[model samples]
Target: MPRVRALSGPKPRDAPEPSHPMPRHLRTLTALLRRAETVTLLAVLCVAGGLWAFAALAAEMLEGDLHVFDETLLMALRRAGDPARPIGGPHLEIVMRDITALGGITVLTLVTISAMVYLVLRRQRASALFLAVAVLGGQVLSRIAKAGFARPRPDLVPHGVDVTSASFPSGHSMMAAVTYLTLAVMLARQEPAWPIRAFFVVVAALLAISVGLSRVYLGVHWPSDVLAGWALGAAWALLVWLVARWMGRRGGIEPDRARPE
Candidate 1:
């Protein structure tokens, strides 16, 4: 008989030894990581909407398009005969001042420092550094916006609080949103439970809202200013959160249980 040609051609050279012999578990991890990154990118894109809102508001304000709206809201909060008198009487003013103090520089600084210290002691050094950068960068942005706009304070009503800064965006509202929201997001990442995470974010949002409202009630910030501050601050907070998530994915910081390494 003629020499029989090998039926299988040397077993197809051992099936070419599979170029990437990744383990099942490793492959699963890779898929999960890609999903996580996709989520982070989507979140950042959504946050851009908030920044766009702020830009729109600023543009409107500059064109005097919002003057009537701002004046209406500001005046509505005051007595018809006397613009100096806020609707809630003296006692309410005192309460508002106290609430406003919660967003004051002293309180925010203390809170930030305490939180950073706690994170540092827990050996989450990267997170602590991130917190500082978030807050300080926000402050810088606030200052630049104030100087750039040089918007005058509301002359229509007597300010309920001693005021000094340019009034295009409320510093109290913006800073409060930045500090509290950033802290809440970082803390939420450590907890795996959905309700707990929701609680953190919701409470942070309430605090920011209250601070912004107080600025308007106190006859200091124009309603539009408060709205702009909220928009910008929220965008900044979300940006910081996205940075944390991105960093965690790269193993540059302590990985979160939420990310599932």
Candidate 2:
């Protein structure tokens, strides 16, 4: 009876334990996103392949197809917008004309000059080099497609714009799209703010698209030609973006600048 010793200090409980597993809904959502990404990649590859095939077909029927399509679109645009007729405002006509000029040397020079300046400022020699390759690669692809197709420019429509290159897919359209899209990617990398980034990208894309459309409005290219240009140009742009992303991940290259938070 010196203090009665406790029979047992403690006893283990034998009851079910609470579970804290991840919610099924969240798990399902995660899996869905991953699956979506995979599907998107597959679709991109399919589009690229399809564009390449179409480019080949266009090449085969280049001169003939360009002539027919250009004529048809010319009539449609003339009835729709009538660049020459001009609805009323002098400003509108001037604006449209200016946009028409955008697909030519002006846009190319702008992008090249800007890229050069960016490289000089940021000291991103590798990125600059890759950018150059992407631009030239797009150009070369355009030329090869044109040469292979040997499509002539529109004669029926009385070309509103001058031409030199063979025209299955519009060269100006391709170049403008590639250049603008490339610049968009570069800026997107540097600017993290989604709204600002989206604004710039949309602006660039719109400018490119307008320039391409202006060609048709001007009675120079077929709608199909411009469309093909867009597809091919977009494919090349995505290819460049993938390259940049790869380089960044590997730490071999840094984008032009960091997005300011």
Candidate 3:
């Protein structure tokens, strides 16, 4: 057979065994990262931050207008949370305000995060860290903002509940938004499908909005206060989500389960 060229000269070193194909999980993650969905998330967060900065600046510029509008809302909810005048019994309004305050949420968030850490220790350390950072940062920001505004609570309306914080923005509302929203995101990351993931996102949003509204309705917060708190809280939530995405990229937390093709 004309010497067959020595059977192709040492069999081409067995074709290097096809490089030992990566595991399915690794392959999938690599493919997901190649799509760069995390980059898009960071872009969205940037936009949100920019928008929040603009809103805060605008509110500062229109401090007089905002104060007027807030007084208007305060007038409407006179019976709900005016700590100055006892209306329909501060009892009911106090209960409602407590329902939306940070104390109960603090306990609830701690328990939830503790359980998640125990259950998902290997895959959720970074998520847990981001959660802690967001919560602490939000609390600090709220304190600073409240002190800077140093706006007195409305004495024109009945004060239905006791509050120690300044009245420019609702601290309880802000903290509830940040804490619950962050926990919701962490929970969403563990789910397998996108729809359920989206559902949780909506639920978190609704919870935050509802808490903000409760503050306004109870007359403990001005409408502007709640609005500012919502904007700031939403911005913080987006920032935390950005950090989580970075963690996912660095293989700190597990990849988000709902990656696209």
Candidate 4:
């Protein structure tokens, strides 16, 4: 007698069995590798594009092509016949100063130190070290670039804030981008949730952007300076992130949460 089927139960669907199990396992690995490659490629493109933009801006600035462009924008922020005052009045100037302070050396130093301590406590020594290098490296690069360019600050208006460095790239803006973005990526990569990662990245980006704008608003930096700062900073952060990610995969650094196989 044939075995009786259970009519109330759902019937199992047939899946063909491969003669070897290797192919099935290989397919999953292949898919994972493809996804990883795609992501890395995109990151490389972003880094390259940012560097290219920075170069273009630098060339134009050196040729004096951005002089009128920078002057027009900088002067527009002042009150008519009052190059000493910003258009938004004393209160707006105050607000801008406060916002700009977010990118200042004191604030960034405090933030980086705090983060490094937290990472140390968490035993993420490699990541903490990487963050430090990323930020400090950006600072070094900023100083070198400024010295190389030797560009002067905007003299079109009395600066809303004090500035004493070369004005080709706003140090505050560049540091803000480097510190915030690097920290954001370090924190985001450790988390498994996409929304959490997105939140960190978005907030970091906004902070960097606001700092750059505040520089221009304060009349301490040429518009091109802020733009160049952002470009270089972003590229630096991404390049460091790529290196960190690569190291993480090799177990040379604190690895991210394991990718799905």
The prediction achieving the highest lDDT against the true structure is: 4
Clashes of each: 0, 3, 8, 0
Give the per-residue lDDT of model 2 (tens digit) for 93-122: 566667877777776867766875786587
TM-score-wise, the better of 1 and 3 is: 1
Q: Candidate 1, residues 11-90: lDDT per residue as tens digits?
A: 44645565778999998989987987788788788689879988999999999999899999988988789888998899
Clashes of 3: 8
Cα RMSD for candidates in order: 5.0, 6.6, 8.4, 7.5
lDDT of each: 0.87, 0.71, 0.69, 0.89
Instruction: Write down the lDDT that model 1 would get.
Output: 0.87
lDDT of 4 by residue, 1-261 (tens): 999976686767598665665676798999878988998999999999999999999999999999888988888888888888888888988999999999999999999999899888989998899889889999999999999999988887778777888998889888899999999888877777778887988999999999998999998999999999999999999998899899999987898764463
- Model 4, residue 25: distance off in Å is 6.9
The Cα error of candidate 4 at residue 30, in Å, is: 3.4
Q: How do these models rank on lDDT, best leading?
A: 4, 1, 2, 3
CA lDDT, candidate 2, residue 214:
78
What TM-score would candidate 4 get against the native?
A: 0.87
Residue 30 displacement (Å), model 3 = 12
- Model 3 quality (TM-score): 0.71
Better of 1 and 2 by TM-score: 1
How does residue 14 of candidate 3 score in lDDT? 48
Q: What are the clashing pairs of model 2?
A: 59-149, 62-151, 63-151
Runs of candidate 3 exceeding 4 Å displacement: 1-54, 57-62, 79-95, 102-105, 108-123, 259-261
